[model samples]
Target: MAELLVAGGGIGGLAVALAAAGRGYRVTVLERRDAFTELGAGIQLAPNAFRALDRLGVGEQVRERAVFIDELRLMDGTTDEVINTMSLGTAYRERFGNPYAVVHRTDLYQPLLDACRRTPGVELCTGAAVTGYEQDADRVTAVLANGERVGGDALVGADGIHSAVRAQMIRDGEPLVSGHTIYRSVIPMDRVPEHLRSNAVTLWAGPGWHFVHYPISGGREFNLAVTKDDGAREAVTGRPTPADHVLAQFPEIGPKAGLLLRLGEQWKSWVLCDRDPVPGWTDGRVVLTGDAAHPMLQYAAQGACMALEGAVHLGSVLDCDAGDLPQRLIDHNYALAPRTARAQQVARAMGREVYHPAGVAAKERNAEIGSLSQAELHGKVAWLHHGTP
Candidate 1:
């Protein structure tokens, strides 16, 4: 069995471990933190994410904790008009092979971590941050922050956007600030106005800003994310912001959306960031996965989905003999670039053109989206939801 080393024990790292162990590869996952825990509020999981999780053996566990929303609605923030609605009913499920759902980030993380612990060939290591890697003809060694070295047949950098492994391999410097800052909150669903509490992932598009809210934590809570294109330079994460400050960012927000936004307390904010996709992320025995490989805007909501899909793809290719592994890694990187890069491009465009349009442009967007039938809506997202493998 090949000794595979995965840097970062987050969802992507644990997922790859689960996938590799199930395929008979001995895997060691090194996490920098003292405890392996996820810290995000909520995450959306498309059918494509479920397809990968089902392959990695954690789909049902996640589904049990998820809130399966019935529709995705787009609204004009200034006019309070429904721009479009895409039903995630039987038709969409039948087309995509799974339902669209949202969950607490922990709900997604814990299942992957539990399965990794239960698997025979997977080892989870804490307080072992991968600083960089050195590879020769036969083996690659990960240099840790504690001044120790761990040897393996190959290394997979599932380490997040600020990955040190990526720093050494790709040397791509820092991530690009999106000039868009998002404020997030989660409030009890029961507290939300009954009329506002719908089983839908709703997005409000305004001039230079947008808002998204959905049911999460098995419908017990609602997750709120509102973003503004304010040309922010520094990268910020989980920074606390007063409710008044957040309210001031979107002057043109509609009355209904304003009511829902006003109810959110304990707000936290993040200045969004991502990198332009590189042509390749493979170097012999060392490679990258997840956000380490491709980080993009949350506009598409496909960042984690792509990571899960990549883990499944990576595990599938590595199920063969180890002698030709380097070539396989090269092939893997090449094949994944086109799809991921397209996603990155699409996500950037959504943020600039669709979500943050002005009066005339916003009306045009609404007119165009309103023209699409449910089947047309399904057709547009089929390429994303029904993925290869």
Candidate 2:
């Protein structure tokens, strides 16, 4: 069997390993952490994500832990008016071949980790950070933080936006700080007033800011993610903030939305960041995947989905028996580049055009989105949710 080394054991890395193992390659995943675990609060999984998860054999497990949402709502934060909403009902499932759902990061991650553990010839290593990589014409090797070297037929850099493997391969400086600060709070459902709790994913868009809330953790917890275009010059991640400070940032939102924001405690903030998509990520027998290859803003809610897609696509195109690893890796990057770039662009656009417009711009955004008929709304998302991109 062929050997593959995957750096980073987050959602993407684990998926890549499972996908390759299914394709008859022996995969070893090198995770830097002390144990195989997932952090973060919640993630929205579109139908495209399910398609990729199903391909990796964990779709059902994820579904068991996910909250199948009723709809996605965009609202005028200041006026308390509904802008647009997309229904994710039976029609949507039938149209897209999958349900739209939200899951705690662990809900999705655990299933992938479990699948990796169950698969034969798949090894999961913790605390084995891949520092860099070296490749000859015949094979590639992962240089570990501990100074140990592991050789494999090919290498995948799924180590996230700050990937060490990517540093060696692409030499792109650092991830682009999006200049937007996002505050997040995950509170138990019981703490939330019944009026604020909902089965739908709702976003209240204000001037240069937005607030999104949804049920996650199988309805046991509510996830709150609110962003501010505060011109934060440096990149920050998961830094705790005073709840009062967080609430003060979005004064334009109506009282009702303001009340909802106030329910959040233990708030943490992250300065959103992503990278400009490059034409290629392949370096001989080594290549980049997930955030290492293409990281995008969370506005599209497709970051995890794109990572899943890339891993599955790579696995499908890599033939162990062909003895053509380099070209196959290059082709994998090429095939996914256009779609990934488009998604990145869409996410960036959504932040500026849809989520943070103000004054007349906000009014026009409301009128335009509110004017969209349900069919028109579904038609607009069909390209993305239909799973091609």
Candidate 3:
């Protein structure tokens, strides 16, 4: 059997491993952390992500732990007025062939790790930070920080936005930081107060700031994410941030949204960053997937979803028995680049015009969102939700 070596055993890497193993390839995943874990709050998985999960055979597990959201509610942050609402209930499932849901990042990661563990041909190795790679005609060798070398048929760079493999392959500089910082937390559902609790995703948009809260942990907890234009460009994650600091960023926010923001404690902050999509991400027996290939701002909420899509496509296209593996990788790059690039560009646009518009632009954005009928709203995202490529 052919062997596939993957760097960075996060969601994309593990999903790729599972997909390859299912196709009769022996897969090994190298993770830098001491243990496999995910840090963050909740993640919204649209139907598109679910389709990829279904193909990887973990859809049911993901669904079991997810909160099936009923609606997506948008409100004016300064006035607490409802701007627009879209349904994500049964009708959405019927249209997209999969339900829209949210899950805690850890909850989602656990099942993928468990599934990888149970698979016969998948191996997970921690404390193995992949430093670089070298590929010859027959095989590719991954060099780890500890100086250990592992050889396999191909090497996948799933090491995230600051990927070492990407550094070597594309030679891109540091990721571009968007002068915005995100404050996030997950609190018990009961702590969210009675009137605020709902099976929906609520987004409050204001001038230069936005707040999103949704149910996660199977409806037992609420994930709160607030983004603000703090004008700080340093890229940092999981850093301790004061609740007062977060509150100060949204002084103009209305009462209800203000209350929800105050409910958060032990908040962590991450500076948002992304890279401009490139023309290609594959070189010989080495390739890139997920954030390493196309990191995007969180406005669209499709980073992980796109990664999942790319993983399935990469696995399906790679054939060890084929005489032209390099060309096959090139084909994978060609198939993914256009779609992921569009997503990346769209996300940046959404962050500016939709989430953080100011004054007149904010009113126009609200009017545009409020004007959308149910069918129109669905139609706007149809290509994204229903697309397989």
Residues 1-389 of candidate 2: C-alpha lDDT, one tens digit per residue: 89999999999999999999999999999999999998789999999999999999999999999999999999889888888898999888899999999999999999999999999879999999999998888888999999999999999999999999888878889999999999999999998898777899999999999999999999999999999999998999899999999988987889878888999999999999999989989999898999999999999999999999898999987765547888888888888899899999999999999999998988889889999987898888887888754
**Which 10 successive residues of model 1 have the least lDDT summed?**
380-389
- Candidate 3, residues 1-389: lDDT per residue as tens digits? 88889999999999999888987889999999999998888998989999999988899999999999899998999999999999987777899999889999987788899999999999999999999998889899999999999999889999999999999999989999999999998899989789779899999999999999998998888899999988978999899999898888888999999999999999999999999989989889899999999999998889889988988988897645635667888999997788889999999999899888999999999999999999898888887788555
* CA lDDT scores, all candidates in order: 0.92, 0.92, 0.91
Q: How many backbone clashes does every candidate have?
A: 0, 0, 0
The better-scoring model by lDDT among 2 and 3 is 2
Models 1 onward score TM values of: 0.99, 0.98, 0.98
TM-score of 2: 0.98
* Over 4 Å off, model 2: none
The alpha-carbon RMSD values of the candidates against the true structure, listed in the order shown, are 0.8, 1.0, 1.0
